[model samples]
Target: MRKVMFAMNISIDGCHEHTHFNPGEDLMDYFTGLMQDTGVIVYGRKTYELMVPFWPEVAKNRTGRPCDVAFADAMTRIEKIVLSRTLENADETTRIVRGDPEGLIRELKQQPGEKIAFSSTSLLPRLLEAGLIDELYLIVHPVLVGENKRLFDNFLVPEKLNYRLEYTRLFKSGAMALHYQKSE
Candidate 1:
């Protein structure tokens, strides 16, 4: 069975907004590798809307930072599963799932693949609460936004979740990529 990984960019103070911090080359490369290995990328409606138009265009026109372009190209090629109640349609290559998002995700995890990469912070809490997340990969940025959405704001676990620290890499920009596997 494939593992479900929550790959998110978070601030020192736990903000999840991408606009809150800048990702350097190393960071982009790290994510690009992730996007390449991901068999299916899952997103919430808001995150889907935010990414749909931009990355695919970058894949076509090949504009922006080299790392960004590469990441975008990889993103364009990955399969996308969008969880939404109101979203009627999505990209031609993407699948729009209405109810039972968690069940659908479980089925995806059981399927033969590299891994299911979750790209939406909005759905993180729900997924984590369900004990569906196999790995938590957080690219912790250096900046601290005193006011903003909390990274684990939506997380509501019945009990404390324990994870084993797999590894950590410190980037030149002072950001660190922390990788952890959920404890059995």
Candidate 2:
């Protein structure tokens, strides 16, 4: 079985929404490189919709961020999976998985690959409850939300899960990427 991982960029207060990248930083390329090693990309319907268009177009707009364009090409090469309830047709190329998310992920674990990833905080706790995700790759932004979207937004009891810090890097904006694995 491959290492199932969850990669997400969130604000200090843990908001997974919004487009945030400081000047002189090519965040998309940074993330795309991560995807290059991934055989599959999975996301909540919202994240898929938000990224689908940009990923393709970023390739064409190699105006300044050359690496970003390369990243776009990398994104186009990978398989994309989306978890949605009401989506009828996700782009012709995207795989849409409806019904029980936990069951689907559990099934994915049985497949041949390094791992599967999910990019939704909304879905993270459920994955945790099911004990599916093996690790987490989180990009923690320094900006705080006095009141905004939360990362641990679910009814997850904090004490139930244990985290083993994997790595940390501080960016110029004070943002950082904190990787953690669930200690079983």
Candidate 3:
């Protein structure tokens, strides 16, 4: 079965606002590498809006640093699945999927794919609670956002979920990328 990986960047204090953290070239490069193994990326409407036009535009314009441009290119090329009932349309590389997001994800996992990646904070709790995520990647940045949406504020699992640390990578910007797999 393909792995369902939930990856996100969070602040030291558990804030999940992407803009709160400053990811350097190394971090961007690392994410770009992660994209290489991902066949489909899943996002909630909010994240989709934040990532779409911006990254695709960046890829087309070849803007930002070399690493950023490369990451943008990779992001634009990869297939994206957005789970939103209200979203009406998306770009060519993106598919807007509605009705039972969890069921759709389970079906996607059974299909042939490299990895099903998830990057939406709004959907994290639901995925975790449903035990749909096979792996988790948390890039902890070395900063604190006093007030914002927290990482696990709404996380409520029926039973305690256990995860085994698979690996970790420390970036030059003092950010740490932690990879964890669900303990079988």
C-alpha positional error of residue 62 in candidate 3 after TM-score superposition, expressed in Å: 0.6
Check candidate 1 and list the clashing pairs.
none
Q: Write the per-residue lDDT of candidate 1 for residues 1-184, one digit (tens) a residue.
A: 8999888888989988889878889999998987877989888899999899889989899999999999998899989989899998897999998878789888998799888988677777788888899998998998888887998887778999999999999988999999999999
lDDT accuracy of residue 51 in candidate 2? 79
Candidate 1: residue 99 lDDT (0-100): 77
Whole-model lDDT per candidate: 0.88, 0.74, 0.91
Q: TM-score for candidate 2, please give it.
A: 0.87
lDDT tens readout by residue for model 3, 156-178: 88999999999999999999999
TM-scores of the candidates in the order shown: 0.96, 0.87, 0.97
Best by lDDT: 3
Superior candidate under TM-score, 2 versus 3? 3
lDDT of 3: 0.91
> How many residue pairs collide in each prediction?
0, 1, 0
Model 1 local distance difference test score: 0.88
Task: Judge candidate 3 at residue 99 and give its lDDT.
Answer: 78
Q: Tell me the spans in candidate 3 whose CA falls farther than 4 Å from its real position.
A: none
Least lDDT summed over 10 consecutive residues: which range in candidate 3? 118-127
The prediction achieving the highest TM-score against the true structure is 3
